[model samples]
Target: MALKPFLLTMLDQATELCHRLAAHGLVVASDGNASIRTGSGFYITRTRSEFENLTVDDWRWMPVVGAPTTGVSSEWRMHQVIFHQLPQVGAIVHCHPPYATSFAVRGEALDGTLLTETADFGKIAVAAFAAPGSGALAKAVIDDLGATGSACLLQQHGALTIGQTFQEAVQRMERLERLAMVQWLVTAGFPAHQTHE
Candidate 1:
Protein backbone atom coordinates (compact mmCIF):
# COMPACT_ATOMS: atom_id res chain seq x y z
CA MET A 1 0.00 0.00 0.00
CA ALA A 2 1.04 3.56 -0.66
CA LEU A 3 2.16 5.56 2.36
CA LYS A 4 0.21 8.66 3.17
CA PRO A 5 1.93 12.01 3.58
CA PHE A 6 1.21 12.14 7.29
CA LEU A 7 2.35 8.58 7.83
CA LEU A 8 5.46 9.33 5.84
CA THR A 9 6.10 12.30 8.06
CA MET A 10 5.68 10.14 11.13
CA LEU A 11 8.04 7.53 9.67
CA ASP A 12 10.64 10.18 9.12
CA GLN A 13 10.20 11.42 12.64
CA ALA A 14 10.40 7.89 14.01
CA THR A 15 13.58 7.29 12.07
CA GLU A 16 15.09 10.47 13.42
CA LEU A 17 14.16 9.63 16.98
CA CYS A 18 15.38 6.07 16.56
CA HIS A 19 18.78 7.39 15.53
CA ARG A 20 18.77 9.81 18.43
CA LEU A 21 17.90 7.01 20.79
CA ALA A 22 20.83 5.00 19.48
CA ALA A 23 23.23 7.94 19.51
CA HIS A 24 22.18 8.85 23.02
CA GLY A 25 22.75 5.27 24.22
CA LEU A 26 19.07 4.55 24.76
CA VAL A 27 19.40 1.71 22.27
CA VAL A 28 22.29 -0.36 20.99
CA ALA A 29 22.94 -2.80 18.15
CA SER A 30 19.38 -2.86 16.84
CA ASP A 31 17.92 -3.48 20.27
CA GLY A 32 14.71 -1.49 19.91
CA ASN A 33 11.85 -0.48 17.65
CA ALA A 34 9.45 2.46 17.29
CA SER A 35 6.14 2.87 15.53
CA ILE A 36 3.39 5.32 14.63
CA ARG A 37 -0.20 4.64 13.75
CA THR A 38 -1.48 5.53 10.30
CA GLY A 39 -4.91 5.68 8.78
CA SER A 40 -3.82 2.68 6.74
CA GLY A 41 -2.52 0.94 9.83
CA PHE A 42 0.74 1.10 11.79
CA TYR A 43 4.21 1.69 10.39
CA ILE A 44 6.92 0.00 12.43
CA THR A 45 10.63 -0.52 12.13
CA ARG A 46 11.67 -3.81 10.62
CA THR A 47 13.10 -6.57 12.79
CA ARG A 48 16.82 -6.11 13.51
CA SER A 49 17.04 -2.82 11.63
CA GLU A 50 19.78 -0.63 13.00
CA PHE A 51 18.27 2.53 14.39
CA GLU A 52 21.43 4.44 13.54
CA ASN A 53 20.94 3.78 9.84
CA LEU A 54 17.17 3.56 9.58
CA THR A 55 15.55 4.74 6.40
CA VAL A 56 11.92 5.13 5.34
CA ASP A 57 12.06 1.92 3.36
CA ASP A 58 13.07 0.07 6.49
CA TRP A 59 9.59 0.61 7.84
CA ARG A 60 6.84 -1.91 7.24
CA TRP A 61 3.20 -0.96 7.04
CA MET A 62 0.79 -3.26 8.83
CA PRO A 63 -2.91 -2.78 8.36
CA VAL A 64 -4.77 -2.20 11.57
CA VAL A 65 -7.76 -4.09 10.33
CA GLY A 66 -6.10 -6.96 8.51
CA ALA A 67 -2.43 -7.22 9.36
CA PRO A 68 -0.35 -9.75 7.52
CA THR A 69 1.86 -12.29 9.22
CA THR A 70 5.24 -11.33 7.84
CA GLY A 71 7.97 -8.70 7.33
CA VAL A 72 7.58 -6.82 10.59
CA SER A 73 9.40 -6.33 13.84
CA SER A 74 10.07 -9.53 15.73
CA GLU A 75 8.20 -7.88 18.55
CA TRP A 76 5.33 -7.03 16.19
CA ARG A 77 3.06 -8.88 18.52
CA MET A 78 3.80 -6.45 21.33
CA HIS A 79 3.00 -3.46 19.17
CA GLN A 80 -0.06 -5.09 17.71
CA VAL A 81 -1.48 -6.12 21.07
CA ILE A 82 -0.93 -2.75 22.69
CA PHE A 83 -2.22 -0.73 19.76
CA HIS A 84 -5.24 -2.95 19.63
CA GLN A 85 -5.91 -2.55 23.32
CA LEU A 86 -5.14 1.14 23.70
CA PRO A 87 -7.00 3.09 21.08
CA GLN A 88 -5.81 6.35 22.61
CA VAL A 89 -2.15 5.61 21.87
CA GLY A 90 -0.83 7.01 18.62
CA ALA A 91 2.80 6.03 18.94
CA ILE A 92 4.94 3.48 20.74
CA VAL A 93 8.64 3.34 21.54
CA HIS A 94 10.61 0.37 22.81
CA CYS A 95 14.18 0.91 23.93
CA HIS A 96 16.81 -0.61 26.16
CA PRO A 97 18.31 2.37 27.89
CA PRO A 98 21.14 1.11 30.06
CA TYR A 99 20.03 2.51 33.40
CA ALA A 100 16.37 1.59 32.91
CA THR A 101 17.23 -1.85 31.61
CA SER A 102 19.47 -2.30 34.61
CA PHE A 103 16.51 -1.83 36.87
CA ALA A 104 14.50 -4.24 34.77
CA VAL A 105 17.28 -6.77 34.84
CA ARG A 106 17.56 -6.37 38.57
CA GLY A 107 13.82 -6.80 38.98
CA GLU A 108 13.40 -3.32 40.48
CA ALA A 109 10.38 -1.20 39.86
CA LEU A 110 11.15 2.44 39.28
CA ASP A 111 10.39 4.49 42.35
CA GLY A 112 7.51 6.74 41.34
CA THR A 113 8.74 9.37 43.80
CA LEU A 114 12.26 9.47 42.41
CA LEU A 115 11.64 12.77 40.69
CA THR A 116 8.90 15.04 39.47
CA GLU A 117 9.37 13.69 35.96
CA THR A 118 8.42 10.25 37.20
CA ALA A 119 5.07 11.46 38.42
CA ASP A 120 4.56 13.54 35.31
CA PHE A 121 4.94 10.46 33.19
CA GLY A 122 2.80 8.52 35.62
CA LYS A 123 4.21 5.68 37.71
CA ILE A 124 6.46 3.25 35.86
CA ALA A 125 5.82 -0.43 36.35
CA VAL A 126 8.05 -3.49 35.93
CA ALA A 127 6.53 -6.34 33.96
CA ALA A 128 7.60 -9.84 34.87
CA PHE A 129 10.27 -11.42 32.68
CA ALA A 130 9.11 -12.85 29.38
CA ALA A 131 10.98 -13.88 26.29
CA PRO A 132 11.31 -11.28 23.62
CA GLY A 133 9.11 -11.56 20.48
CA SER A 134 6.75 -13.87 22.31
CA GLY A 135 3.10 -13.59 23.13
CA ALA A 136 4.05 -13.85 26.78
CA LEU A 137 5.98 -10.59 26.55
CA ALA A 138 3.07 -8.95 24.77
CA LYS A 139 0.71 -10.12 27.48
CA ALA A 140 3.02 -8.76 30.15
CA VAL A 141 3.16 -5.38 28.46
CA ILE A 142 -0.60 -5.29 28.03
CA ASP A 143 -1.03 -6.16 31.69
CA ASP A 144 1.28 -3.33 32.68
CA LEU A 145 -0.63 -0.95 30.42
CA GLY A 146 -3.79 -1.99 32.24
CA ALA A 147 -2.33 -0.17 35.20
CA THR A 148 -2.31 3.58 35.55
CA GLY A 149 1.19 3.99 34.10
CA SER A 150 2.85 5.50 31.07
CA ALA A 151 5.89 3.27 30.94
CA CYS A 152 6.70 -0.36 31.61
CA LEU A 153 10.02 -2.06 32.26
CA LEU A 154 10.21 -5.43 30.50
CA GLN A 155 12.09 -7.54 32.94
CA GLN A 156 15.43 -8.71 31.57
CA HIS A 157 14.56 -6.98 28.32
CA GLY A 158 13.94 -3.27 27.98
CA ALA A 159 11.30 -0.56 28.30
CA LEU A 160 8.19 0.58 26.44
CA THR A 161 6.32 3.87 26.43
CA ILE A 162 3.20 5.03 24.63
CA GLY A 163 1.99 8.51 23.85
CA GLN A 164 -0.64 10.45 22.02
CA THR A 165 2.02 11.41 19.50
CA PHE A 166 5.34 10.15 18.19
CA GLN A 167 7.31 12.95 19.77
CA GLU A 168 5.65 12.47 23.11
CA ALA A 169 6.47 8.79 23.10
CA VAL A 170 10.10 9.49 22.29
CA GLN A 171 10.28 12.13 24.98
CA ARG A 172 8.79 9.78 27.53
CA MET A 173 11.43 7.14 26.68
CA GLU A 174 14.18 9.68 27.18
CA ARG A 175 12.62 10.91 30.40
CA LEU A 176 12.30 7.37 31.67
CA GLU A 177 16.00 6.86 31.17
CA ARG A 178 16.88 10.15 32.82
CA LEU A 179 14.74 9.33 35.82
CA ALA A 180 16.29 5.89 36.03
CA MET A 181 19.78 7.37 35.96
CA VAL A 182 18.99 9.82 38.72
CA GLN A 183 17.35 7.13 40.79
CA TRP A 184 20.37 4.88 40.40
CA LEU A 185 22.83 7.57 41.41
CA VAL A 186 20.78 8.69 44.37
CA THR A 187 20.20 5.21 45.67
CA ALA A 188 23.80 4.16 45.21
CA GLY A 189 25.23 6.72 47.61
CA PHE A 190 22.70 9.44 48.33
CA PRO A 191 19.31 9.43 50.01
CA ALA A 192 16.84 6.66 49.26
CA HIS A 193 13.85 8.99 49.48
CA GLN A 194 13.12 12.43 48.19
CA THR A 195 13.67 15.42 50.43
CA HIS A 196 10.46 17.18 49.51
CA GLU A 197 9.81 17.96 53.15
Candidate 2:
Protein backbone atom coordinates (compact mmCIF):
# COMPACT_ATOMS: atom_id res chain seq x y z
CA MET A 1 0.00 0.00 0.00
CA ALA A 2 1.17 3.50 -0.83
CA LEU A 3 1.84 5.32 2.41
CA LYS A 4 1.23 8.87 1.29
CA PRO A 5 0.96 11.62 3.89
CA PHE A 6 -2.60 12.33 2.80
CA LEU A 7 -3.55 8.78 3.77
CA LEU A 8 -1.91 8.82 7.18
CA THR A 9 -4.69 10.50 9.19
CA MET A 10 -7.30 8.48 7.37
CA LEU A 11 -5.61 5.31 8.56
CA ASP A 12 -6.26 6.20 12.16
CA GLN A 13 -9.72 7.61 11.43
CA ALA A 14 -10.79 4.57 9.48
CA THR A 15 -9.46 2.26 12.18
CA GLU A 16 -11.46 4.09 14.83
CA LEU A 17 -14.57 4.04 12.66
CA CYS A 18 -14.27 0.30 12.25
CA HIS A 19 -13.89 -0.23 15.98
CA ARG A 20 -16.89 1.98 16.66
CA LEU A 21 -19.00 0.24 14.08
CA ALA A 22 -18.14 -3.14 15.55
CA ALA A 23 -18.93 -1.93 19.06
CA HIS A 24 -22.32 -0.71 17.89
CA GLY A 25 -23.02 -4.00 16.11
CA LEU A 26 -22.84 -2.39 12.67
CA VAL A 27 -20.19 -4.85 11.45
CA VAL A 28 -18.97 -8.27 12.52
CA ALA A 29 -15.96 -10.50 11.98
CA SER A 30 -14.47 -9.90 8.54
CA ASP A 31 -17.73 -8.71 7.09
CA GLY A 32 -16.97 -5.12 6.11
CA ASN A 33 -14.51 -2.94 4.22
CA ALA A 34 -13.88 0.81 3.94
CA SER A 35 -11.95 3.08 1.57
CA ILE A 36 -10.87 6.70 1.23
CA ARG A 37 -9.93 8.58 -1.92
CA THR A 38 -6.22 9.31 -2.19
CA GLY A 39 -4.66 11.88 -4.51
CA SER A 40 -3.92 9.20 -7.11
CA GLY A 41 -5.99 6.25 -5.90
CA PHE A 42 -7.65 4.85 -2.78
CA TYR A 43 -6.64 2.66 0.17
CA ILE A 44 -9.09 -0.13 0.90
CA THR A 45 -9.11 -2.56 3.79
CA ARG A 46 -7.52 -5.83 2.84
CA THR A 47 -9.48 -9.08 2.64
CA ARG A 48 -10.03 -10.89 5.97
CA SER A 49 -9.25 -7.78 7.94
CA GLU A 50 -10.86 -7.69 11.35
CA PHE A 51 -12.27 -4.20 11.43
CA GLU A 52 -12.23 -3.74 15.18
CA ASN A 53 -8.57 -4.70 15.23
CA LEU A 54 -7.40 -2.99 12.04
CA THR A 55 -3.83 -1.74 11.79
CA VAL A 56 -2.53 1.17 9.73
CA ASP A 57 -0.79 -1.37 7.52
CA ASP A 58 -4.02 -3.24 6.77
CA TRP A 59 -4.95 -1.20 3.72
CA ARG A 60 -4.09 -1.85 0.07
CA TRP A 61 -3.60 0.77 -2.59
CA MET A 62 -5.62 0.43 -5.76
CA PRO A 63 -5.99 2.64 -8.81
CA VAL A 64 -9.34 3.55 -10.31
CA VAL A 65 -8.81 1.15 -13.21
CA GLY A 66 -6.71 -1.91 -14.19
CA ALA A 67 -6.90 -5.34 -12.56
CA PRO A 68 -7.55 -5.27 -8.81
CA THR A 69 -5.24 -7.16 -6.46
CA THR A 70 -6.82 -10.16 -4.75
CA GLY A 71 -5.29 -9.57 -1.29
CA VAL A 72 -7.24 -6.36 -1.07
CA SER A 73 -10.89 -6.42 -0.12
CA SER A 74 -13.01 -8.34 -2.58
CA GLU A 75 -15.42 -5.41 -2.87
CA TRP A 76 -12.76 -2.97 -4.10
CA ARG A 77 -14.30 -2.97 -7.54
CA MET A 78 -17.53 -1.59 -6.15
CA HIS A 79 -15.65 1.31 -4.60
CA GLN A 80 -13.47 1.85 -7.64
CA VAL A 81 -16.39 1.76 -10.05
CA ILE A 82 -18.35 4.24 -7.95
CA PHE A 83 -15.36 6.58 -7.78
CA HIS A 84 -15.08 6.46 -11.54
CA GLN A 85 -18.82 6.98 -11.92
CA LEU A 86 -19.21 9.79 -9.38
CA PRO A 87 -16.49 12.32 -8.83
CA GLN A 88 -18.09 13.92 -5.78
CA VAL A 89 -17.91 10.82 -3.59
CA GLY A 90 -14.70 10.72 -1.58
CA ALA A 91 -15.23 7.64 0.58
CA ILE A 92 -17.02 4.30 0.60
CA VAL A 93 -18.32 1.98 3.34
CA HIS A 94 -19.62 -1.55 2.85
CA CYS A 95 -21.05 -3.50 5.76
CA HIS A 96 -23.64 -6.09 6.72
CA PRO A 97 -25.23 -4.40 9.66
CA PRO A 98 -27.88 -6.80 11.00
CA TYR A 99 -31.10 -4.85 10.45
CA ALA A 100 -30.25 -3.70 6.93
CA THR A 101 -29.04 -7.14 5.89
CA SER A 102 -32.29 -8.62 7.16
CA PHE A 103 -34.26 -6.34 4.87
CA ALA A 104 -31.90 -7.03 2.00
CA VAL A 105 -32.18 -10.81 2.30
CA ARG A 106 -35.95 -10.53 2.34
CA GLY A 107 -35.82 -8.47 -0.82
CA GLU A 108 -37.39 -5.42 0.80
CA ALA A 109 -36.54 -1.75 0.74
CA LEU A 110 -35.94 0.02 4.00
CA ASP A 111 -39.15 2.00 4.35
CA GLY A 112 -38.77 5.61 3.32
CA THR A 113 -41.92 6.55 5.23
CA LEU A 114 -39.94 7.94 8.14
CA LEU A 115 -39.95 11.56 7.15
CA THR A 116 -36.81 12.48 9.02
CA GLU A 117 -34.72 9.65 7.64
CA THR A 118 -36.32 9.79 4.20
CA ALA A 119 -35.54 13.47 3.89
CA ASP A 120 -31.87 12.67 4.23
CA PHE A 121 -31.48 9.26 2.60
CA GLY A 122 -34.33 9.74 0.13
CA LYS A 123 -34.89 6.00 -0.38
CA ILE A 124 -32.76 3.02 0.63
CA ALA A 125 -32.82 0.79 -2.42
CA VAL A 126 -31.97 -2.93 -2.64
CA ALA A 127 -29.97 -3.85 -5.71
CA ALA A 128 -30.71 -6.96 -7.72
CA PHE A 129 -28.75 -10.02 -6.55
CA ALA A 130 -25.23 -10.34 -7.90
CA ALA A 131 -22.36 -12.51 -6.84
CA PRO A 132 -20.05 -10.84 -4.37
CA GLY A 133 -16.66 -9.61 -5.69
CA SER A 134 -17.96 -9.37 -9.24
CA GLY A 135 -18.19 -6.33 -11.51
CA ALA A 136 -21.88 -7.13 -11.91
CA LEU A 137 -22.33 -6.52 -8.20
CA ALA A 138 -20.70 -3.11 -8.59
CA LYS A 139 -22.96 -2.25 -11.50
CA ALA A 140 -26.03 -3.38 -9.60
CA VAL A 141 -25.17 -1.14 -6.66
CA ILE A 142 -24.36 1.79 -8.96
CA ASP A 143 -27.66 1.37 -10.80
CA ASP A 144 -29.62 1.25 -7.57
CA LEU A 145 -27.83 4.22 -5.98
CA GLY A 146 -28.69 6.42 -9.02
CA ALA A 147 -27.54 10.00 -9.52
CA THR A 148 -28.52 11.51 -6.17
CA GLY A 149 -26.11 9.04 -4.53
CA SER A 150 -27.45 7.79 -1.23
CA ALA A 151 -26.90 4.47 0.54
CA CYS A 152 -27.86 1.18 -1.14
CA LEU A 153 -28.73 -2.33 0.09
CA LEU A 154 -27.06 -5.24 -1.65
CA GLN A 155 -29.63 -7.98 -2.21
CA GLN A 156 -29.26 -10.87 0.20
CA HIS A 157 -26.08 -9.17 1.22
CA GLY A 158 -25.50 -5.87 3.01
CA ALA A 159 -25.26 -2.09 2.71
CA LEU A 160 -23.01 0.35 0.83
CA THR A 161 -22.66 4.06 1.53
CA ILE A 162 -20.71 6.79 -0.28
CA GLY A 163 -20.01 10.28 0.92
CA GLN A 164 -17.79 13.32 0.48
CA THR A 165 -15.68 12.05 3.38
CA PHE A 166 -15.01 8.83 5.26
CA GLN A 167 -16.69 10.17 8.37
CA GLU A 168 -19.75 11.08 6.36
CA ALA A 169 -19.84 7.66 4.74
CA VAL A 170 -19.56 5.98 8.12
CA GLN A 171 -22.41 8.10 9.47
CA ARG A 172 -24.57 7.25 6.47
CA MET A 173 -23.92 3.51 7.01
CA GLU A 174 -24.93 3.81 10.66
CA ARG A 175 -28.03 5.80 9.78
CA LEU A 176 -29.21 3.35 7.15
CA GLU A 177 -29.07 0.41 9.55
CA ARG A 178 -30.67 2.42 12.34
CA LEU A 179 -33.51 3.39 10.05
CA ALA A 180 -34.00 -0.21 9.05
CA MET A 181 -34.00 -1.30 12.69
CA VAL A 182 -36.64 1.25 13.59
CA GLN A 183 -38.81 0.26 10.66
CA TRP A 184 -38.56 -3.40 11.58
CA LEU A 185 -39.42 -2.74 15.19
CA VAL A 186 -42.52 -0.74 14.30
CA THR A 187 -43.79 -3.14 11.65
CA ALA A 188 -42.83 -6.45 13.18
CA GLY A 189 -44.39 -5.62 16.55
CA PHE A 190 -41.24 -5.28 18.63
CA PRO A 191 -39.62 -8.43 20.16
CA ALA A 192 -36.71 -7.08 18.14
CA HIS A 193 -35.47 -10.33 16.69
CA GLN A 194 -32.91 -9.72 13.94
CA THR A 195 -32.92 -12.27 11.14
CA HIS A 196 -30.01 -12.36 8.71
CA GLU A 197 -28.24 -14.69 6.29
Candidate 3:
Protein backbone atom coordinates (compact mmCIF):
# COMPACT_ATOMS: atom_id res chain seq x y z
CA MET A 1 0.00 0.00 0.00
CA ALA A 2 1.13 3.51 -0.74
CA LEU A 3 2.06 5.68 2.23
CA LYS A 4 0.23 8.98 2.67
CA PRO A 5 2.12 12.24 2.06
CA PHE A 6 1.83 13.30 5.68
CA LEU A 7 3.33 10.02 6.81
CA LEU A 8 6.12 10.50 4.33
CA THR A 9 6.65 14.01 5.60
CA MET A 10 6.81 12.79 9.18
CA LEU A 11 9.50 10.33 8.25
CA ASP A 12 11.37 13.02 6.34
CA GLN A 13 11.21 15.40 9.29
CA ALA A 14 12.38 12.70 11.69
CA THR A 15 15.28 11.87 9.41
CA GLU A 16 16.18 15.53 9.15
CA LEU A 17 15.94 15.96 12.90
CA CYS A 18 18.32 13.08 13.47
CA HIS A 19 20.75 14.54 10.99
CA ARG A 20 20.58 17.90 12.67
CA LEU A 21 21.38 16.34 16.04
CA ALA A 22 24.38 14.61 14.55
CA ALA A 23 25.53 17.82 12.87
CA HIS A 24 25.41 19.62 16.20
CA GLY A 25 27.42 16.84 17.91
CA LEU A 26 24.53 16.28 20.29
CA VAL A 27 24.39 12.60 19.43
CA VAL A 28 26.97 10.30 17.94
CA ALA A 29 26.42 7.21 15.84
CA SER A 30 23.41 5.32 17.26
CA ASP A 31 23.56 7.13 20.57
CA GLY A 32 19.95 8.30 20.75
CA ASN A 33 16.35 7.71 19.65
CA ALA A 34 13.30 9.86 18.90
CA SER A 35 9.54 9.40 18.37
CA ILE A 36 6.45 11.17 17.13
CA ARG A 37 3.13 10.29 18.73
CA THR A 38 0.40 9.24 16.33
CA GLY A 39 -3.25 8.69 17.08
CA SER A 40 -2.94 4.91 17.41
CA GLY A 41 0.79 4.48 17.87
CA PHE A 42 4.11 6.20 17.20
CA TYR A 43 7.07 6.20 14.79
CA ILE A 44 10.54 5.64 16.28
CA THR A 45 14.08 5.12 15.12
CA ARG A 46 15.10 1.52 14.65
CA THR A 47 17.79 -0.06 16.81
CA ARG A 48 21.44 0.40 15.78
CA SER A 49 20.51 3.09 13.27
CA GLU A 50 23.13 5.81 13.09
CA PHE A 51 21.71 9.30 13.17
CA GLU A 52 24.06 10.75 10.56
CA ASN A 53 23.17 7.98 8.13
CA LEU A 54 19.51 7.63 9.05
CA THR A 55 16.99 7.07 6.24
CA VAL A 56 13.26 6.51 6.24
CA ASP A 57 13.99 2.78 6.49
CA ASP A 58 15.52 3.42 9.89
CA TRP A 59 12.08 4.22 11.30
CA ARG A 60 9.39 1.80 12.39
CA TRP A 61 5.72 2.18 13.22
CA MET A 62 5.03 0.83 16.72
CA PRO A 63 1.70 0.08 18.33
CA VAL A 64 1.27 1.98 21.54
CA VAL A 65 -0.11 -0.90 23.59
CA GLY A 66 1.73 -3.97 22.31
CA ALA A 67 5.07 -5.57 22.93
CA PRO A 68 7.70 -3.73 20.97
CA THR A 69 8.88 -5.44 17.81
CA THR A 70 12.47 -6.69 17.39
CA GLY A 71 13.90 -3.76 15.44
CA VAL A 72 12.65 -0.92 17.60
CA SER A 73 14.86 1.01 19.99
CA SER A 74 15.64 -0.61 23.33
CA GLU A 75 14.39 2.48 25.14
CA TRP A 76 11.03 2.27 23.42
CA ARG A 77 9.49 1.41 26.76
CA MET A 78 10.46 4.84 28.09
CA HIS A 79 8.93 6.54 25.09
CA GLN A 80 5.85 4.36 25.27
CA VAL A 81 5.22 5.13 28.92
CA ILE A 82 5.61 8.85 28.40
CA PHE A 83 3.10 8.88 25.55
CA HIS A 84 0.61 6.79 27.44
CA GLN A 85 0.79 8.88 30.58
CA LEU A 86 1.26 12.34 29.12
CA PRO A 87 -1.48 13.04 26.62
CA GLN A 88 -0.22 16.58 26.06
CA VAL A 89 3.11 15.42 24.68
CA GLY A 90 3.31 14.95 20.92
CA ALA A 91 7.00 14.16 20.51
CA ILE A 92 9.97 12.80 22.47
CA VAL A 93 13.74 13.08 22.15
CA HIS A 94 16.20 10.95 24.10
CA CYS A 95 19.89 11.60 23.76
CA HIS A 96 23.15 11.31 25.69
CA PRO A 97 24.45 14.77 25.03
CA PRO A 98 27.72 15.23 26.92
CA TYR A 99 26.93 18.27 28.99
CA ALA A 100 23.51 17.21 30.15
CA THR A 101 24.41 13.59 30.69
CA SER A 102 27.31 14.79 32.77
CA PHE A 103 24.82 16.11 35.25
CA ALA A 104 22.97 12.82 35.08
CA VAL A 105 26.09 10.86 35.89
CA ARG A 106 26.96 13.14 38.77
CA GLY A 107 23.49 12.86 40.25
CA GLU A 108 22.90 16.56 39.71
CA ALA A 109 19.78 18.18 38.37
CA LEU A 110 19.15 21.29 36.30
CA ASP A 111 16.53 23.87 37.20
CA GLY A 112 14.65 26.56 35.29
CA THR A 113 16.39 29.28 37.30
CA LEU A 114 19.47 28.66 35.20
CA LEU A 115 18.23 29.91 31.84
CA THR A 116 15.29 31.58 30.13
CA GLU A 117 14.88 28.55 27.86
CA THR A 118 14.53 26.39 30.92
CA ALA A 119 12.20 28.79 32.74
CA ASP A 120 9.01 27.05 31.68
CA PHE A 121 10.45 23.62 32.38
CA GLY A 122 11.05 24.15 36.11
CA LYS A 123 13.27 21.43 37.53
CA ILE A 124 14.74 19.00 35.03
CA ALA A 125 14.14 16.00 37.29
CA VAL A 126 16.60 13.15 37.59
CA ALA A 127 15.31 9.61 37.67
CA ALA A 128 17.10 7.08 39.85
CA PHE A 129 19.43 4.81 37.91
CA ALA A 130 17.82 1.75 36.40
CA ALA A 131 19.19 -0.53 33.75
CA PRO A 132 18.60 0.76 30.26
CA GLY A 133 15.46 -0.43 28.48
CA SER A 134 14.03 -1.83 31.70
CA GLY A 135 10.49 -1.29 32.92
CA ALA A 136 12.00 0.20 36.04
CA LEU A 137 13.62 2.94 34.00
CA ALA A 138 10.33 3.58 32.24
CA LYS A 139 8.52 3.93 35.51
CA ALA A 140 11.15 6.27 36.88
CA VAL A 141 10.85 8.55 33.86
CA ILE A 142 7.08 8.74 33.86
CA ASP A 143 6.99 9.20 37.60
CA ASP A 144 9.29 12.19 37.36
CA LEU A 145 7.86 13.85 34.26
CA GLY A 146 4.28 12.92 34.98
CA ALA A 147 4.52 14.94 38.19
CA THR A 148 4.47 18.20 36.23
CA GLY A 149 7.76 18.36 34.38
CA SER A 150 8.69 18.56 30.72
CA ALA A 151 12.23 17.13 30.88
CA CYS A 152 14.18 14.55 32.87
CA LEU A 153 17.60 13.04 33.34
CA LEU A 154 18.15 9.30 33.56
CA GLN A 155 20.59 8.84 36.40
CA GLN A 156 24.02 7.86 35.14
CA HIS A 157 22.47 7.55 31.70
CA GLY A 158 21.08 10.41 29.62
CA ALA A 159 18.41 13.05 29.16
CA LEU A 160 14.86 13.01 27.77
CA THR A 161 12.65 15.82 26.59
CA ILE A 162 9.05 15.98 25.36
CA GLY A 163 7.06 18.61 23.53
CA GLN A 164 3.87 19.38 21.66
CA THR A 165 6.01 19.42 18.49
CA PHE A 166 9.17 17.68 17.39
CA GLN A 167 11.08 20.92 16.98
CA GLU A 168 10.11 21.97 20.45
CA ALA A 169 11.47 18.78 21.94
CA VAL A 170 14.68 19.06 19.94
CA GLN A 171 15.14 22.64 21.02
CA ARG A 172 14.56 21.69 24.62
CA MET A 173 17.34 19.15 24.43
CA GLU A 174 19.64 21.79 23.01
CA ARG A 175 18.65 24.26 25.67
CA LEU A 176 19.25 21.63 28.33
CA GLU A 177 22.82 21.07 27.24
CA ARG A 178 23.39 24.78 27.05
CA LEU A 179 21.97 25.21 30.54
CA ALA A 180 24.24 22.50 31.88
CA MET A 181 27.26 24.11 30.28
CA VAL A 182 26.51 27.49 31.78
CA GLN A 183 25.77 26.01 35.14
CA TRP A 184 29.09 24.23 35.17
CA LEU A 185 30.91 27.43 34.25
CA VAL A 186 29.21 29.54 36.87
CA THR A 187 29.77 26.97 39.58
CA ALA A 188 33.38 26.34 38.62
CA GLY A 189 34.48 29.97 38.90
CA PHE A 190 36.02 32.28 36.24
CA PRO A 191 38.89 31.58 33.80
CA ALA A 192 38.92 27.94 34.89
CA HIS A 193 36.86 25.57 32.69
CA GLN A 194 36.17 21.90 32.99
CA THR A 195 35.08 19.45 30.30
CA HIS A 196 32.95 16.36 30.61
CA GLU A 197 30.94 13.80 28.67
**Candidate 1 TM-score over all chains jointly:** 0.90
Q: After superposition, how far is residue 197 of candidate 1 from its true place, in Å?
A: 25
> Using alpha carbons, what is the TM-score of model 3?
0.93
lDDT of 3 at 86: 84
> What's each prediction's TM-score?
0.90, 0.91, 0.93
lDDT of each: 0.84, 0.87, 0.88
Model 1 CA deviation exceeding 4 Å by range: 65-69, 189-197
The alpha-carbon deviation from the true structure for residue 109 of candidate 3, after best TM-score superposition, in angstroms, is 0.5
Q: What are the candidates' C-alpha RMSDs?
A: 3.4, 4.9, 4.0
Model 2 per-residue lDDT tens digits across residues 20-93: 98999998899999998886688899999988888888888888777776689988889999988888889999
* Model 3: worst 10 consecutive residues (lDDT sum): 188-197
**Which wins on TM-score, candidate 1 or candidate 2?**
2
Candidate 1 lDDT tens digits, 72-135: 8898888888788888888899989999999999988887577776676656788988899898
Instruction: Flag the better candidate by TM-score, 2 or 3.
Output: 3
